[model samples]
Target chain A: MMTLIVLGTLLYSQYRKTTSDKLKGSGNVPYYLIALLAIGMAVGDDSGMTMILPSRGLLIWFDPILEKLIE
Target chain B: MQTLRISSNQIAMLTGCFLSAGMIVSTSKEMVYQAGQDAWTGYFFPMVYGALIIVISIWLYKGREGITLFELNKKLLGGIGGSLLNLVLFWYLLSMLITDLRKLAEFVKTTLLLNTPVSVTMFMILLLTVYLTRGGIEVIARVGHLYFFLLAATIVSLPILLINEFSLANVRPVMANGLEALAKSSFMAVGSYGEVIAMISVMFAFSYQKNPKGLHPMLRGVVFGTFLLTVLSVTLIGTVGTSISARAMYPNLMLVQSIHITDFLDRLDIILVSFWVPSYIIKICLNYYVLTECISSIPSEKQNPKAYTIVLVPLVFMMGHLSFESVVELVHFETHVWSFVTVFLQVVLFSVLIVARLMRDRQRKKEVELT
Candidate 1:
């Protein structure tokens, strides 16, 4: 909860600054979205909800093959 | 918005600290396990590989003043191809950052804060990393310069302080493992040392007063770092012997715990850890800085570096949590998978870029000659 609040505040300020500066290109929407997704996943993981999959499972397939070749 | 620049000496110090800091804690045991008492000999491979990386980096930096590796890729490989390479590099660097964060957090949890949650330790470290990174590379370099001296002083004193514990016979029977086993052990160390290639991303920031010394300063830094690691490997094996050093989780920490100088000077591991934590933080800060630099240069419609840095904090936090389930898994991934990926990027991919640059240079030279 505290992590969300801090990140939310940061994202909001960034959004404000991006708009107030009237940057030439797109706004901070994409960054905000990414941050929100990441924070959600982090919160979920901390809460034992498994919002994100551990990368080890994804990369573990290659380990045995590489280990043999390296050996 | 202002351009940031750091002196060659500063970058050298930063590279030294960046390369040697974490290896002392996490990697020595693996090397000892692989090569037995001949672990110190394994550093020779990384020393050579690291020199090759520095040479190639200097070669790429020539004729391209003030341009970063991302920009150089775009220039040499065109838009789509360059961005693809950048994304690949980004993924690799992100993995590096995640691993470093987890490794440091785990070390702290095991050593100092046994009761503290890994998440809290990681969060605190990332908070510091983000704060230091926001100050830009110059700030990171300055902090590295200060910590580098302290790290060197502490590392240099390890042998002297632990002299009583030394057993010269412990490191004997060195080549009993044969040359093939020694070669295999050296291959693992290459990935750790190849991390010096991270300097390529920030090579644009190096400010040379006269004719640039090419790879001299960086190579010297790497050689010095390798020397320090060699001293550490020798000390760890010499004092603790191969069996204990290999079996211990962090042999360097164990070696430090044995520092009983006249019974008064004990618990030196605490002092060592105090100096070590900052150096590890600097390493993480550099990785974070490079990752952000890569992201900001991805030729996006919205190229906001600061926004990306802010957003990346939570993402890194999340990934750090989701990367590895345990230290054993992390070590396995590092040895088998991460080492190959890093070596491929630094050795194979950079070789491709070097060849492309050479071909382009030849074509330009021929056209000029025709004109």
Candidate 2:
């Protein structure tokens, strides 16, 4: 479920090119939103960090799909 | 008169300092007891993986064009989605900073300043970091350079200190843990080396050479950083047996504590820690820069440090307090979860984007030819 959400955000960022930066929102709510979300992940389940470290062989294979998607 | 500043050399020094980030805390005999005598070899694979990462990063930003990861995130992701991705990236930077602070405070309390609250240590360090972050990237670079000289002076004396304990047999027996240990060690190392991922943010904000060609300096910096990390790992495994090395938090500290040049040279851990502070300073600057840049890059956004830093201070403080556990917990999580996400996101994710972008470009070229 969480992967889906994170993947969605990643995909969306690729297409939208729109970011919620200090210059965007008036209240600075988005700033904290981003900070808390990121730190939360750092402190989140270590096991959940699987999206980053696949086995070496797996990384080599995942390379192709990643290229297609990000491009 | 304009003040003299740090050049690429200084930045390289800072990188050397951080290369030991989890090493000190995680290489403890206890922390790495899982790997037994093979822990040093285990650390070697990660350095190899990290070297690969550095090569790719330099390739991606070939011109020293200063294209930040956040900006690249946008260019690759696009307007709205890219912006949001930057936000997520921003927080990732924050979380790392907090984790570093937590580690520093823990080391201080356990080894020195026994009565000092973690908050006091963290706040003091972070306040210095905040001041440095606002001092501009050049100043950050300059300060890092100065510390590099100091770091060099201290690190060079390692052999002198550990000369008594030197033994070749301790690291004997090639492939002691079998192939599996090598594989797992590489995996653990992937995350450690991945800490260099923090560079993308700073590289982006760096002064451009009109193109990214000068990135060789950064790449060279990474090579130097890895070399130092390799030495630290080997010496650590040497001075302390693999079992003890893995279990001791800040194994390097233990290594330092064990070293004795003269009877008068006993308490040099303080000297090592003093030399260590600059690397943390540069590292803190890097983290804060990433956080600030991510927030500032919000489309149509202008940053006011007062509004941002004020809130950031306490939030970071809270994270430190909340995560006051043994180095083992930190290492367990870092090697497990942190390692996974960092490798996936930094390496796997980028590789994916490059492939996608290239294939798409090729497809478009084909369509143009057909037309």
Candidate 3:
């Protein structure tokens, strides 16, 4: 996808531009976190993403239970 | 570093407009639906609640001039702790941005640009937001000030324009379902109206004209927003009656549709749609700036703030597209999921920050005296 390519380039550029300490210290975790989140959202149901966080299999079981509670 | 400064009035307009703009179309309908005829009460609850949030947030930053909540997070929580919190804040703001874009896209698709794809509409708005934000917050604040009157006039004049249709009987049995229903609706209102918490990002961006009276122009601006929202709710319920307004997706848009104006001016919903554009853009830009600022807190990111917007555009587009099954799902998410999380962040997280700041200050004072 265009987004993946763009993001890959940005990440590579960012990775090359800054040191590991700066990246870690500057709070670059969100870049990876958000990249994964976008992929999960785009893949839809199969991504098994929960509404709350970006973990792959973490809350997949919980969402259905929450839905049942709403019902 | 060259710091940008906007007046307190600009801050007030920017924050006030950001908070109130989309309520008429998106959130107020749910409140009316939940509380029946008494939904006007929902407006008052969040007004008081939001004002308190502003007070506490401002007080927390009172002596700590030039510091943002993001910096406070770094100081109190340390690098890793703060980065993790920043991730949480990113999720919060990003989720909001996606939702707002979806709502705006929905409005555009339904009312104005019927043939346009929702993704296209959303992309268009985000494109504008990126442009606004690249100018930095000052430009956005100035734009909010410039168009504040146009936005306010369009919103306030709607109820007045449709005064002929209101029925006093509509809101008659005000607390018919009693306090419990009202309380439920108020809780939901926190998600929609109490988003003033987002303004804390821009709090330090404001340069006060005078040496600070307690929350002066900012509080007034917030009160004005609340007043507009309350009036909007009252007008919708009074005119369309509670049951009809409750069921309507956009009660205010419906109100605009009801106006004949003249034979020539009948399709005034188009013009009303124009009002939402600036206000919604202001809101989106504010949130986007906050998210970007949080992201930029990473040392590598400090070099390129606007670069992230390029990456965010497709992510936002996809999230807005894929997040909900329908408008029903969107409303359900807003009431059930988003409301509680937002309140928790505003109240509980803010309290933690205040306590942490106090302890930090005490330790600093002790060291000063020791020296």
lDDT of 3 by residue, B195-224 (tens): 776677656645655345666666777788
- Would you list the rank order by DockQ, best first? 1, 3, 2
Segments of candidate 2 deviating more than 4 angstroms: A1-27, A32-71, B1-6, B28-32, B62-64, B207-215, B299-307, B324-326, B359-371
CAPRI verdict on model 1?
A: acceptable
Error of 1 at A61 (Å): 1.9
Choose 1 or 3, whichever is better by TM-score: 1
Off by over 4 Å in 3: A1-46, A49-71, B208-211, B298-304
The lDDT of model 2 is 0.59
In Å, residue B204's CA in model 3 sits off its true spot by 1.6
State every prediction's TM-score relative to the real structure: 0.91, 0.76, 0.87
CAPRI quality of model 3: acceptable
Best by lDDT: 1
- Specify the highest-TM-score model's number: 1
Greater TM-score among 1 and 2 belongs to 1
lDDT of candidate 3 over A1-71, digit per residue (tens): 53564366456546654543334443455556666766666555324343543221212333345345433
Model 1: per-residue lDDT, tens digit, B188-298?
A: 777788777677687554455423655566777888888888888899999999998888888889988999997667887898889999998999999998887777666
True contacts kept of 2: 0.06
Share of native interface contacts recovered by each model: 0.39, 0.06, 0.17
